[model samples]
Target: MSRLGSFAGDKMKTRGRKVRGSAYLAVPFVLLAFVATASTAFAATESTSKTAIFARVTWKVVKPGDAVDFDLQITNGARLGEDPVTYDLKILDLPEGWQEKFFYQGEQVKSLTLKPGESLTVTVEILTAPNSSTGIYQLTFMAYSWMAEYASTQSLSVELREPIREINLVATFPGIVAQVGETVQHSIVIQNRGESGESLRLSALAPEGWSTRFITQDKSEVSSVYLAAGQSITLALETETTDNATPGGYTLTVRASSEDGVVNALMELMIALREKENVSDFDFVSRFPEVTAEAGKSLTYPITLRNLSANDQEIILSVVTAPEKWKTAFKSGDTEVTRITLNPSQSLDLIFQATPPSEVSVGDYSIVVEAESGSTVKQVVFKAKVVGLYKLDVQPSTLYTSVTAGNPLTTTVKVTNSGLSPVTTLSIQVTAPSGWDVSFSPARALSLDPKDSYSFTVTVVPPSNTVAGDYLISVKALSDQYVSDEVQLRVTVEAPTSWALAGVVVAVIAVSLLIFIFKKFSRR
Candidate 1:
C-alpha cells in the first residue's frame, strides 16, 4: 500500500505541470479516450470469501457418517466474464460438535481475499463425519463481500444424491386383480445400484400371519447383508385375507436407505377391481356454427376446422362466401385466414364477422359460407334480409350529364319511395371538376314527397382559360345523410373564336346594297 501511495504521489507531482489544457476539453478528451476506462473500472472489485463454495450437501441416516458433494460456482458480482480463481476445497458435515479444518496449498487460510475480480472455487473434496444422519442435509457457503460496494452475498442448498451404498427397491404385485380371502403374493426386488455395497435391512407393513420374508425366510431377515453394487435379491410378501378383510385398494412401500438418503418402491394392490376401460378412436367431426341476423345488423361466429384422424393428417381448409354485399373478414391468430393446416386431433377456431349492408332490399337473401376441408366440403348458411318493406326508386341509378360553361342547366330528378319505408336526411349536392365553379339551387337540401319529382339547376362556371374538353363532374344525391348516387358528367367547352362577329358585317352589307338599289329605281 505504501509503495502504491509513493508511486501515485510522485506521478501527481510530475503531472501537475501537464494540466495546462482548458477544463472544457477534459470531458471531451475523456469521452474520446475510453480504451482503458472499462478495464480500470473492473479492476476495483474485490472478492473476500472462501474459495470453495458448497452449492449442495446431503447427509443420510442409513449411512450415519456419509455425505455427498455436487458442483457449484462462485462469482464476483461486479466483474463477470473472467476466469474464477481456483483452490482446493473441502466441505465438512458433522453431527453437531465436530471440528472442521480446510487447507489451501498446505496452509490453513484464516480468510483469503480472492484478488480483484477473482473467485476461489473448490470441487475436489467432500468432508463428512465418521457419523452423519440423514433424511436430507444442507450446507451454506460462507458469505462473500465486495469491499468497495460494501455488499455481501451467500448461497445455501441441499441436494439428494445416491450414496456409495445406494439401494433401489422395486416391488411388483401378481395379476391385475386381488380380493379378500385370497392368498395374494407379491415380490420385493432389492438391488444395490450404487457404486458401493449397502448394508441390507428389512421390515414388514403387516405382521402376524400376514407377513414378509426373504427367500430364506427368517425373522432377523436381513442379518446377512453387504449387498454389492448392481446385485439383486428378491423378498416375498404373503398375505391371507380374513373373513372381515375389506375389499379395496392398498399400497405397500418398500424403502431402502443409505448414508445418503432413502429410495423406495411402491406395490399397488387392487381389490374388487374391474376390467380396464377401453377408449375408442377420435373420429368426431366438427360442426360449423349457424348465424341469424336482422336487417342492417352484423353477427360474428366461429368456424372450427378439426382433424378427426388417428394419425397426423395435414388437413387444409379454404373458405368461400356466397354474398357479395355482406362484408366478411376472417382472422386467425397470426396470418390472414386464407388456407390453414391442422395436426391430428387438433382444431383451429376462426372468428368470422359478417356485416350486412344496410342498402340491400328488404327481402330474404340466402347467404352461404362454405368451408372446404381437404376432400370434405361443408356449408354454413346465413339468412339475410333487406327488410325491403318499401324502397324509393330513383329513375337514374347514378346521375351523369354534361353542361356548357357558365350555363345553369336544369334537369328533373325522380325519386320514387317504392318501399313501405320512408327515409330521412335527404340532400343533394352538385360538384364539378377542380378549377370549375359549381352551385345548385336549393343547394343544401330538398324535401321531396313520396314519388316526388323536382328539377334543380346546376350552374357550372368555367374559369377564364379553363381547359376546354372533357372533365368529370359529380352529382351526388344522398338518402339518410349518406351518398346514394354519384353521377359523373363529361363537360366540353368550345374555345371562344374570333369569327362570331364576321357574320354581322356581311348581313349589314347585304341590307345596305338592297336599300341603295331601291332608291335608284325609284328616282328613274
Candidate 2:
C-alpha cells in the first residue's frame, strides 16, 4: 500500500481499538475517582478549550424573492489531535422569512469532515421570501462538532431589497388579414404595474418600404410615452403595405422599452391579391387626346378604334359635332374611309385630321367623332386648341386695268384679317411709280375682326404729261396689330381720245398749208 493509505489505515485501526473487560467494568469507579481529582485535572485541560477552527463567507447582498449563494471556507488550523474532525454546518439569527441551506460540493449536507492540516469548502444557499422586508441583516453561521466538543462561529451581513417592478404589453389583435397595397391599423395596451412611473420608448421593425406610425390617446404622434404607476394606455399603430409585397404571411414586431427592461409583441399579417376588372367592349380612344394648333392649321391624331364585340361588324364613321367651319376627316393610311369592317376584337389605327377655320376663336375647342355600327353608335370627343396667328392678306379686285393718261381709274381693294385676333387701327398704304398718283376712299385706319375683310375704292391717276406705258402700283393695309402684303396692281396708261383728235386736226391744217405753199413755190 501507498504510504498515505497505510497511514490512514493505521488511524482507522486506532479508532477501533477495544478495551479489556476489566477496564470497561472499572469505567464507573474511574469516573468517581476522577471526580475527586477533577479540580486539579481541569486546570491542566483549560488550554485546549479553544478549538482550532475558522470560517468565512464569500458575499453579502440579496434581493427579496431571489436566491443568493455564497462560498463558505472552514479550516482546522490547529494540531489539536491526530484524528479526523467532523463539523456541523448551521445558520443563526436569520430573517424570519428567509431560509438557508448548506451544501457540500453540489449536494445538501449537514456536516463536513476535515483532517489535521486540512480545509473544506462548501456553499451556503439563502432564499428570501416574497414578502421579506428590505433591510440590512446580520446572520451568524456556526460550524460545531458534538463529539469533538468544539465549535466555530462566523458573522455575515445580508441585504434584502424590494421586489422588481414589472410592466405588461398586450396587443388587441396579434394577426390581421389585408389586401395587397392596403393600410392596416391596430391597437396595443401598455400597463405599468409598479409603484413608480415609467417612461417607455416605442419602435417597430418591418420590411423595406413599409411605413408605420404610433399615435397616442389624443391622436398625437410620439416616440415615447410616460405612464404613471398602475396606469394603462392604448396606443394606435398604423401600417402600410407595399404594392409588390407577396400575398403570404409576414411577421412584424413592435417593441416597448424602458431603462429597467424591454418587451415586444409579434403581429402576423396575411395579404391577398386584388382582382382585376375587365375592359369595356367597342371603345374608341384617341392616341393624343388633346392637341394644340394655330387657326387655319390642320392636325392629325391617331386613334385606336376597336370593335371588342365577338362578331364581325361594319361601322360608319362621321363627324357629329365640331367647332364651326372646322373640317374633320377619318382616314386609313392615306385613304379617306367613311365605313369599315372589323372582326372580333379587331382594332384599326385610323388617322383623324381636324382643320380649324381661320375665323375660329383662340381657345380650346372640342370635336366629337361618331362611329355607327347597326343601331349602336359610339362618339368620342377630342380637344383642339386654336392658337393666335399674326397674319393679314391684301387682294385687289382688278390686278390689271386700262387707264387714260390724264383721267383717273378706280378699283376695289380688299383687306383681310387672317389672324385669330382683331386688327385695329388699320390703314391702307399705296405705293406707285413716279408721275402716278393713287388714293384710297377711306384713307383713315379701320378695325377688322378675325377672318374679316374690308373693301375700299382705290383711285389711280397718271400725270397729264405722262408718256403712255404700262405701270405698276402696290397696295397694302398697315396697322399696329397687323400688316398686309403689298399686292401689285398693274395699270396700262393710254392717251385720251381728245388729245388724239387735236393731233389729227393740227396735222390736217399743216398738211393743207404745206400743199398751198408747195403749189406757189412750184409756179415761181
> Best by TM-score, which number?
2
Per-residue error at 367 for model 2, in Å? 4.9
How high a TM-score does candidate 2 get?
A: 0.36
lDDT of 1 by residue, 470-520 (tens): 776666566662344565655666444433367678889999999999999
lDDT of 1: 0.49
Per-candidate TM vs. native?
0.29, 0.36
- The list of candidate 2 runs beyond 4 A from truth reads 1-286, 293-299, 305-348, 352-359, 367-381, 387-425, 435-437, 449-453, 460-465, 477-513
Which 10 consecutive residues of model 1 have the lowest summed lDDT?
12-21
CA lDDT, candidate 2, residue 263 = 37
Q: After aligning candidate 1 to the native by TM-score, how far in Å is the CA of 414 from where it should be?
A: 5.5
Q: Poorest 10 consecutive residues of model 2 by lDDT? A: 11-20
User: Per-residue lDDT of 1-524 in model 2, one digit per residue for the tens?
Assistant: 54323322343233111123456576566545634443233332223433343445544666668887777677765575867778877675566667788898789998888886677778888887777666555555667565323455555656666534567777767677777788877788888886557888878777789898898878898888888879999988888888787777776677777755653333443334353224345777787978898767897888887888898878889888887778889999889999889899888899999987666777898888988877677888888877777677888998889888888899998888877777778878888888677788787555788778888888888988878888889988888766777888888988888889999999999999999999999999
